[model samples]
Target: MSKELRSNFHEQLTEIRDGIAQMGAGVTELVPRATQILLDGDLEAAEYVILGDNEYDAKAVELEERCFSVIALQAPVASDLRSLVSAIKIIADIERSADLCVNICKAARRIYGHDLDPSLRGVIQKMGNQARVLFKESTEAYLNLDGPRAAALHDMDSYLDDLQRQFIQVIFESHAAGTIDLQVAVQLAVVARFYERIGDHAVNVGDRVRYIVDGWVPEHPYAESDNDPPEIVDGVIVPAGQS
Candidate 1:
């Protein structure tokens, strides 16, 4: 490649990376806003998060187009090939993250104007915090090209899964004890599920980072443990609660 052509390619790649980062940041904001809306019973905030989905979708489409253009025009090889491929995969993950945020907003709408038990709120908040941390760390790993950091982010997804299980157990126990109304318990379940899905998307981003650096895709969607089943302490599973 000529020096000038190489410079232009680098510029385009930088733009693509920046676009992905913008999408990541946008979805990160959405997660917290959606969680807060649910916690505060704020219908307007929840609606805003829902409406913001279009922006994320648009950016993702643009990023994908840019990646395609780079791959076709530059004919990148080796690490460059991996980077472009990773960009394509990252855009898909970002789109799904946005969709998960939309789901959270939808859950918030269902529970709008309803009072939630403080314990349930606490559980949701904890899940939200964990999801946010995973998102931030995954993006940082991408920006820094730190595959090990990305791998660590995948490990954190298990924490989100554990928290989701605890949330569901609390809801079930509360309903069984007659402390929480069945209807409210079900809504809280949906909220926890949304948060759990957000965590899954974050792990997906981490996997993409691994692909970017090592050109290797994870066999499973979520973090996998070294131990085998039957003796496995926590199995690797996407969306959690399923084999």
Candidate 2:
């Protein structure tokens, strides 16, 4: 490749990376707001989160198009190609995560008037905190290319799953006691699922981050690739759960 062409491709690549990073940051900010809105029954805040999703969606679409354009125009191979591929996958995960937040906001709308059982509310709030930490750490891992740190997220995710189930059990307890209406219980269940889904998406991004930094896509069928991308640093550097 000519010098000018290589420079231009690098610039485009940086822009794409920055775009994904910004998207990650956007979601990181929104997660806490979504959780707070849920806890406080803030209908106005819920509406804000719901409407903000469109901006993130537009960003996702633009990033995906940029990735495809880079592939077509630069024919980036090896690490350059791998970087773009990982960006595409990461963007998808981030977008879904943003949707999950929007889903939480939607759930907020459904249950705003219902009084939550105190025990169930506490557990659900903890789950929200866990998920927000995961989201923040996952984003940091992506921006820093910390492979091992990315892998560490799965443990916390397992814990998040357990917390989600506990929240549901509490809801069941409330329902059995005739404290919460059936419709309200179901709505809270859906809210728990949304937060749990956010954790899943964070773990998905962690896997992608490891792939980007170490070029070692895990033994998952969906991640199997034909290209012989260059290997960097022998082992994965998974990011652990952050405070």
lDDT of 2 by residue, 1-243 (tens): 999999999999888888898898888878888888888889998888887878988999999999999999889898888899989988988887888787777667767788877897798779888998888889989888898889999998999999999999999999999988877777777778777878888888888888878788667654412211111111322221110
Give the best candidate by TM-score: 2
Question: What tens-digit string does per-residue lDDT give for candidate 1 at 150-201?
Answer: 9897579899999999999989987887876766677677667667777777
Ten-residue region with minimum lDDT total, candidate 1? 225-234
User: What TM-score, over all chains together, does every model reach?
Assistant: 0.87, 0.88
Clash numbers, per candidate: 0, 12
| Number of the top lDDT candidate | 2
After superposing candidate 1 on the true structure, give the runs of residues whose Cα lies further than 4 Å from its correct spot.
Answer: 221-243
- The CA lDDT at 8 in model 2 is 94
Estimate every model's Cα lDDT from 0 to 1: 0.76, 0.81
